[model samples]
Target: MAENTCVRCGAIPPSHDVVSVASADGSFRLLCSRCFNTEMADLAEVHAFEHPEFTPVRLSDADGVVHEFHFRSLLFGDQLSLEAFEPVPGDDDYAGFRFQVLGDPRSDPFELLGNLVQKMKRALAVKHLVEDAGHLVVAETTVRGRIEWDGNERDRLPCVVI
Candidate 1:
């Protein structure tokens, strides 16, 4: 089957029927449906916080899953609140608020990313994790941390990040 690349992470679709949505503004150019939802929602959240006149609303897919979450801008020093509605089986309804003054972007990519993806999955009770490109990893019920650090074999490895 001819492969189609996901615009978000550049990973090819696993199946022919995988749905994808792309934006025309040259921002989110190419994204599979799943990734597109994630990215769009993130952008909406940022925009709502930045622009007060625009009231943000929830966005969902055909199945009515809460795919997008957004909130209106809050005043400085005012408390922000978040509340999630019904969550899917493998998903959780998350609610929280954060306030931070605009600052310069961090230079370290990993620093901006924070802890490794594996650690986050565990915290979220997620069982499946697709690493850079197409490396899929499943976590067992029991936590058995394994770090594959082969210092000498650099040439044979796939560059996970560009």
Candidate 2:
């Protein structure tokens, strides 16, 4: 009877489940479910960009001309940036575009992507009537630069007024 330690977070009595992952050398490393799932999700995100199931998302412009954008990486943060390969008409080289999702950092990145895919599907079903609506929009105050998730307004005060 010995307590197992999670190699990733070093949690003795793990927050929840513990899983064993085999290394290349055939040794196993124990990790709590949170750490293991986070690692798996990160891998999945990488795979989605590297080997996307859907390629060349087609959306029509106001002029009804279709534009294709190849799937690219999703940069995660308070404001998520989705990069794609967009080929411009009359342009020989393929260009890149970044569609941003501002605010709502509380939402999981994967969940946001899922919601976007759902919206895209709905828009496509409607024959692309939605104009210039490729980006995900969240209702929150847009702030410039990096957002400090840990800090509060009190931390920014020079002095407390009486």
Candidate 3:
């Protein structure tokens, strides 16, 4: 429909889980959680979760490819990052990330981070990367200066696909 609108369902209704997913044509669109998951269902894993900092978010899709999100500091430091690893063939090797954030440094080390909003958006970008293989592309190279990687298939698969 229009720019900044969901391609499948026009105009995002009021909600906080609106996500921007990549279109096959190599662009991005804003989709509500339902629509977003539907659009990406064939390509990756999509789920709702909160950052260790307690910010809520959801994401990924299933395709014959893989997607991952990378976050670089908007300011700089031992910035928090994310990843969804591959399932070891014929093994119960699952996929996941090392998600954590700090607010007061005394917040039990897990509180609403200093930049909650931006970091939440960045973590959301890490959602729904398909557990597949292929060439690597920066799905969202940067989120408010944080980088999101649709990162999968960076290296050759250890086993055959089919």
In candidate 3, how many clashes are counted? 17
Q: Tens digits of per-residue lDDT for model 3 on 1-162?
A: 444465667865432334666777999768755465444433333233223323223333322233332221110122222222233345332323323343322133232443543454455455233234685333444422223343355953353111
Among all candidates shown, the one with the greatest lDDT: 2
Tens digits of per-residue lDDT, candidate 2, 107-151, equal 455555566555544433333222247853332343122222322
- Which scores better on TM-score, 1 or 3? 3
Error of 1 at 90 (Å): 29
Instruction: Give the range where candidate 3 is weakest over 10 consecutive residues by summed lDDT.
Output: 70-79
Clashes of each: 1, 0, 17
lDDT score at residue 162, model 3, on the 0-100 scale:
15
For model 2, what is the C-alpha lDDT against the true structure? 0.45
Evaluation by TM-score, superior candidate among 2 and 3: 2
Instruction: Tell me the tens digit of each residue's lDDT in model 1 across 21-68.
Output: 435765434444345434544654433332122223344432333333
Clashing pairs in 1: 7-30
**In model 2, how large is the Cα lDDT of residue 42?**
74
Q: Number of the top candidate by TM-score?
A: 2
Could you arrange the candidates by TM-score from highest to lowest?
Answer: 2, 3, 1
